[model samples]
Structures are given as C-alpha cells and as structure tokens.
Target: MQQHNDTIDSAASADEPDQIHEPRLWRDKGWTARVIKNEDGEGWAVEMIRDGSAEPALVGPWTMGRNKVDPKPLDATAHQTLVKTASEVIRRHEQQLHAQLNKEVSIDFGDDVVSVRLTITPDEFEPFGTLIALNPLGDVLATTNVRPDFRLTRESAGRWAADGFGKIR
Candidate 1:
C-alpha cells in the first residue's frame, strides 16, 4: 500500500504532462500554440496565445505539406518552429483586435429583441465567486453570486429563449 501511494504521488507530480491527440503547452509564461484539426478534416487551425492575453490572441488556418496531406503530428522539432510562426501570427492578430473594438457597441433593444452586450466583471476576493454583467446600454439585468460554478453564455441564452425574449423555438 505504501509503495503504491508513493508511485501515485510521483506520477501526479511528474515534471512532464502527457498529451496525445490533445494540444499541450510547454510553458505558461512564453508564447504557446495549440494545434487543432477540423472534425471534418477540411483543414487545420492553430490557436496562438501569448503572455498577458486572456484568450487566444490569434487564430488562422494551417497549410499542408507538399504531398497535399496534413503535416505530421506535433513533436519537439516541429514545436520549436511552430512557436516562431505562431508568435508572428499573434503579433498580427493583436494589431487587428486593437483596431476592431475601438468603442462600445451601440445597443438597440426592442420589444421582441434585446440587443445588448454583457460585460462580465468577476470578483475573486470573496470565498464565493461573484460576477456582474452589464449591458451595452449600462443596464443591470441580473446579479447572482450564489453558485460558484456557473456558465454565463449558455444560461443567459437559454433563459432568453425560454422567456420568449430570443427567437421562438
């Protein structure tokens, strides 16, 4: 029993993380890229994220090898090159997003449709997580911190659909 426990602990704290068919990050601080393949095999895409970005800073389609086939799986040698290419892609995307969201969206909410943008601000100080979402017109629709585990997008959409605020099902 003691030996088995030790082995489990060592494996849990292993220096390397095992990733197969799933993207893995070599390091957290520097540039990181995840290779994702289309389910239909139409094409491949690389989601590149850099330091200080909340989400993937850049995303673009990937090319195939000369044989007109998918490039080989990700490995040490290929990973090194990917880092360089992905970084440049992100540098370009950052410039684009910066130019896109120049100002807040103009909301036009009607009786049948509610056109609003919810900006969720999370409070991490308290024990129970708290998040406040404000609409583009600066309206507070709902406020809740009761449940720690909650999804904003799905829940909000479902509620709107159920309440007949969204398109009828």
Candidate 2:
C-alpha cells in the first residue's frame, strides 16, 4: 500500500467526474471521506463531506494502523459506515429545523374542535409567521399573519377563537 497524505492529488480532484478510491481518500456515492491529522490531538481523524457541500457533515477519530503511527487505510466497509453516519446527521438536523419552524395545536371552540397551525418563515430582515385555523373536517376557518415570535398555546388559541379570529395584537 502506498503512503498517503491529507491533500487530494490532481487525479482525485473533487470536480473530476470519476470516483476516487485511495488509502486516505474515498469519493463515491455522492460523499467523500478524507483522513486528516487531528488538529486538536496527536492522532488522526476522518471527515465525511457530501458532494457540493462546503463542510463535512461528520468528523470523528480514526483508527491507527498496525504500526500505531500511521492512520488506518480507508476501505469499502469503513467508507459505507461513514456515509451512513453522515447521512443520518443531515437527516436529524432537517427534522429538528422543521419542528422549530412549524407548530400545531387543537382546541375546543364553541361546540367544534379547531386545529391551529403556526408556520414561521425566517428572513434576514423580517421574520413572520402565519396562523391558520381549521375546523374538525379540515376546512379553513380563519387565517392571519403574525410575528414570528408569537407563542401559540392553548390559552392564546382560545382567546384568538373567542375574538372571532381577528388580528392578533
């Protein structure tokens, strides 16, 4: 096996069309795994970056070779594991963001149950939220715009319903 360094050679350029499989680098299945020296410690670390992304989605300590000096070589099994772990990290981040931007609640208004949903649109200048009320059958009852910081709770939703779904003050 050839000794490898952290930097990618010309043949393994990210822009190249062909996939690369090297001792320290593996680029395939839309992901690239690179073994690099750990800046914070004496050992080595591996980072998995998705294609077209500017940063690595996952980075962790790498195993040492039998010599206990050089880093272990990248192999098919290790590459697949790294890809799977990185993909999961991306998926979890997306789910957490979605939950933060969307909220929902159900409340009893008069003789019917109403479902209230608040969806927030984040912007650099002005962030806003939309509050929508739906009847038990999922028919739209009312819709209005509100500030992104608006808190949607059982008490607030009840008050909004009692006020005939007028503009929130």
Most lDDT-accurate candidate: 2
Model 2's TM-score against the true structure: 0.87
lDDT: worst 10-residue window of model 2 = 1-10
Spell out the clash pairs found in candidate 2: none
- The TM-score values for the models, in the order shown, are 0.31, 0.87
Alpha-carbon RMSD to native, per candidate: 15.1, 6.4
Candidate 2: regions farther than 4 A off: 1-16
Local accuracy by lDDT, each model: 0.50, 0.93
lDDT for each residue of candidate 2 in 1-169, tens digit (9 for 90 to 100): 2435435454465567658889999998899999999989899999999999999999999999999999999998999999999999999999999999999999999899999999999988999999999999999999999999999998989899999999997
